[model samples]
Target: MAHAARGADAVENDAEGLRRRVAALLEAHWDEARGYSVPNPSIYPHLWLWDSCFHAIVWAALDDPRALRELEATLDGQLASGLVPHMRYGDAGPDTWLGPLERTSSLTQPPMYGHAARVLADRGSRPADELLTRAVRGLDWLWERRRTELGLVYVVHPWEAGNDHAPRWDDWGAPGRTRADYDRAARTAWNKARMHDVTFAADGSAEWSSSFVACPAGFNAYVAFNLAELAELLDDAVLAGRAAALAEAIDEHLWDEEEQLWADLAVVGGGASARSPTSEGVMPALVTTDRARALAALRQLDDPDRFGAPFGPANVTRTHPAYDPDMYWRGPAWPPLSYLFWVAFARLGLHDAAAGLRARTIRAAWRSGFAEYWNPEDGRGLGAVPQTWAGLVLAMGA
Candidate 1:
């Protein structure tokens, strides 16, 4: 009894320490402008879509009022067409490429606002109706402006995918190309698309003029899951149906039967490109209702040579030629992604796996003081120190 009591006391102390650290980090990054939360105070001063969503989620876990403000501030940056920019910079920042035009980038990150809003609403941080309205608008925007004929939404830029510099974009525009070359081609395609007046049509079709587009499995899964959550919040049958259909489309189009995993497909010249697999590809399994398929996908997480590295689930698989432990998204283990997979594992009844991952993540954060990511091989923290999502460890523990 004495030993068990001591262990329990240690756990409580650790939890308190995590909560204190997260609260301090959140306070540090809270922008005065409508209480928007930045991903990092220095490295990423701008309000990032997914980062804000994550910030709100962790805040909601603590029942903080800043949670509501974070979502509302992000909503204020939404465009008239319902497309929320991936990054919204404050007026004081150094001039960026988009400074000549709108301060917000035309591109967008994963549609996670709906998911974040739903989480906040569930925690009673905001009114369900208000959050539902905002979420539906964002969903409608994606369905109208980003959806392809194949029934999946496509991202026009690598940054918009939130897995910038990932191996998946290595051959974005042309095979055997460098990152700089791909960026130039993507930029040129984006400009042409904008010049041609690409916009969402009244008939639910996108008047796209860009050749650079990709339907990433992980991104589409996130959209589908969030749409389902929004549908439940709003009790909207149409959105629910669309969400189901989208999930089906992802399975049909992105799942590789032989590999037993989900992969990304680039829409090039109105046709599907070859399949590209990354650690993000496993995300679809999180939302999959098909037991067999979900189990198969989860199996990849247990493969030591693949995602089950000592400190991973690396961002890219170990077997991939482009695997580099120090590279940002190419192979490093991010806390956000690890937390997400932990949730998925728990939901899928892989409780032991989930608990193990949670232990690893907590230890890594404790060792590194919330670094952006960790080296999957050595468990060494990398990237921005004291990252916002790295503080997500607090919520994960809760």
Candidate 2:
């Protein structure tokens, strides 16, 4: 009994230490001048869309005053057209292939700010009218300009998908147009091959010809999840109906029955689905009312042949030949993704699974010195170290 008690005490102490370190890391990344946390100092120094969303969520969870403040930064480049650029603040956020703009990226990322803002509201950090309005505008802009005829959201660029190097793009790859293009060279090629003619609409959303198009399970899932949350918070029935329609579309188009995984749909020449398992495929559970499908997708995480990993589910499943433990998106364990997945599982009533994922994610980030992403096979930090994404660990406690 005494030995067991000592072990438990040691575990508690370790958790407390991790919490302190994560807090300090988030503080260090905080840009008081900008009133938002920079994702990382070395590689990613500019403000980003989803990164800011996660930062705001972490701050809200800590009950810190910075929650709403950080969230405000997410709207830094909101145009009159209601589109918010994926990255802003400076040139570092812009890319050579696009966004010849002065300060913002030409594209948008997953509209995670909606979910972040709703989380803050629930925590009594409800944003003021301006914040809420911009949030709604951003969503409206995407719904109007970006939604496919199928009612599912489509990403014009692979980068917009936020899982840049994911194998879901392999079918439209540079070479085979269907090869396993892993390290992002194909994606870069696609970017460079663009017409280099980007025109901004009256609303300020960038418009380009011959763009890449795909409907990702994760991106659409987040759309549904965020829309559903915002509708409930604001008592908007139209948004609720839109959310339900989108969720139904995701179930109809993205779910792959044979594979028992949610596959990303590439919409370039036609509709092509990814065959390999990916962590993003499991995200629909957050809004999926199809219990049987949600449960099937959830089971993949427990299958060692697929997403199962020591840290969390691999970005790409372990069984795939493309799974590279140390690579960026191909197989690393990303903290922000872990948080999203944890919420999805919890929403699906898998409390124990969510708890395990939350604990593993916190420990993994702590052991990795708050990396941007890390090798899931080991606790080794990879990508940008001392990243604020690790700050998400505080949110797991919430």
Candidate 3:
């Protein structure tokens, strides 16, 4: 018993140390003169909206005002069309950040602007109406760009949609694209699991190995959440009306009743192939969705042999043949995935379930010491150690 106690104590100490290191790393990487910038390891000044927002929450816990500043940097990148370009070119070259032209795909990820805005509100960090308006405009942009005649936002880039590991990619790659076509100079140094086409660049930025397109789950869920919040804040019934319609459409398209989960569409036959379903699916319960059928669809959340592992939620459903615990993006126990599940449970009033998942997530992240991703069955770390987003997720302890 004494030995067991000692072992437990050792693990606790290790977790505490990791938390501290994460805090320090965040502080060091913060570039105040440049508006509290946080770069993806290999590239600098190419701002990412979701990543910065994830870090901002931790910053809010530490210094509320700086957290607000971090968000400003993200908002700065929003285009006139309400499109928040995935990256903000600061000093990096074309080779960095996936060709650096704000992507050609008309559809981009639903910027979870409302969530970030709400976070700021929690801290009493108010900027200006202009900022909020710009965010809203970005949402409007989505309604225009992504919404099809069917009203569902079509995701053009997997990364833009925010479900980076969506099962759809395991089959059909980006719409009519291949890894060899990517500019090698833009590969991010921080991401270890990449298939970069080039080793070097003129601007010292490395490129990526693989390119992906159009996954819809997280992007729509986020937009739905944003629209809901906007409806409340602005009394814009039109916004809410459109958002509701989009939600219904997304449910109809993405929810595979047979699989009982949310997944992105996959393309077949290279660039010329038609879109199909991929096995890399995640539970819709990961995000807040109010469609009546959503709950029934998520019943598979705790199926022991499939997704319910000793850790927490796995990005890919365990039943899928492609479920590999060691793969970088496919079946990894990612903090972002767990983060969404934590929120979804809380929102649904599944307090007990939420608390349990939160604990597992915290345990996994702390144990992994903020690795970029982890093995689904064990808390062993993999990929980038002390990753910024992982640390932020850890600090968000449920």
Candidate 4:
């Protein structure tokens, strides 16, 4: 009994420490602009779309009112069409690379804003009506401008998918170049063309000649999840119907029965008809309604030669020829992705797996001081330190 009490006390102390760390990290990155939370203080000083979503989740978990402000700040950058840019630079800092004309990029990140806003409102950190209204407008914008006839929305740039350098984008010509060069060349060119069409054309017909457009399975899953959440909040049958239809479309088009996983499909030239199997592809299984299929897909997370690694799940299958534990998204285990996997596992009743992953993730972040990602093989922290989503470790306590 004494030993058990000591163990419980240790756990309590650890939780307290994590709470303090989350507060410090978030406050350190809080931009002067009301709710904007930078991913990192020194490295990423601008507000990012999905990063802010994760920040909101962390803040809401801590009962911080700043969570609502973070969501509102991101929405402030939303375009007239309701399309939110991937990142917004306020006042053009010294490190601003895109020049002084535009404060934000034309492209957007994964559709996690609605889901994040719902999370905050559910926690009583924000009003549901206000956030849901903003979410619906953003969803409408995406449906109008990005959704394909096939039902799944398409990403014109790999960065928009938030899995930059993933094996799925290998054929789209993303690897082997510095991230700076890749952004300046492929991303900049695509954004410029998109901006031109959206600015000059009345119908907003932006034709992407580049072969990088793709319907990523993970991205569509996020869209469907967000739409369903918004539909529930608004009690709108039409939005609910759209969400169901989109979910069905994803299962039909992206699911691979033979491989027992989901994969991306190219919507433009230059991309492979069949994307290489990666952890990002299997992420959609989290929202899958098919029990047997979801179970089968979850098995991939346990395969030693696939996502299963010594420390956590790798971003790409270990057996894949392109797997690189040291590379950014090719194989490194990211805290945000790991947190998503934990949520899915817990929802699927895989409590033991989820608990184990939560422990590993929290331990890794603690050891690395909130680095952007970690080596799945040795658990060595890499990339930006004090990353925004690294604070997701605190959510385990909630």
* Best of the candidates, lDDT: 2
Q: Which 10 successive residues of model 3 have the least lDDT summed? A: 267-276
Off by over 4 Å in 1: 1-13, 92-101, 173-209, 269-274
Runs of candidate 3 with Cα error greater than 4 angstroms are 1-22, 37-45, 94-107, 164-166, 173-215, 265-292, 297-299, 394-398
Better of 3 and 4 by TM-score: 4
* Candidate 1 per-residue C-alpha lDDT over 92-202 given as tens digits, one digit per residue, 9 for 90 to 100: 643334312355666678877877877777787654466557768888888876788889988765566678667776654332234344344564554444434434344
Give the Å shift of residue 53 in candidate 2: 0.5
lDDT over C-alpha atoms for residue 206 of model 3: 26
lDDT of 3 by residue, 5-30 (tens): 23433554365564565677677677
Best by TM-score: 2
Decreasing lDDT order of the candidates: 2, 4, 1, 3
Whole-model alpha-carbon lDDT for candidate 4: 0.73
Candidates' lDDT values, in order?
A: 0.72, 0.77, 0.57, 0.73
Candidate that beats the other on lDDT, 1 or 2, i.e. the better one: 2
Q: Give each model's clash number.
A: 0, 1, 20, 0
Instruction: For candidate 2, write residues 261-380 as lDDT tens digits.
Output: 778887663234255578898888889899998888887776678887887778888988778878777788898888887887887788988888887777677667678888887767
lDDT of 4 by residue, 38-58 (tens): 897777878888888888889
Better of 1 and 2 by TM-score: 2
- Which has the better TM-score: candidate 2, or candidate 4? 2
TM-score of 2: 0.90
Task: Give the clashing pairs for model 2.
Answer: 81-203
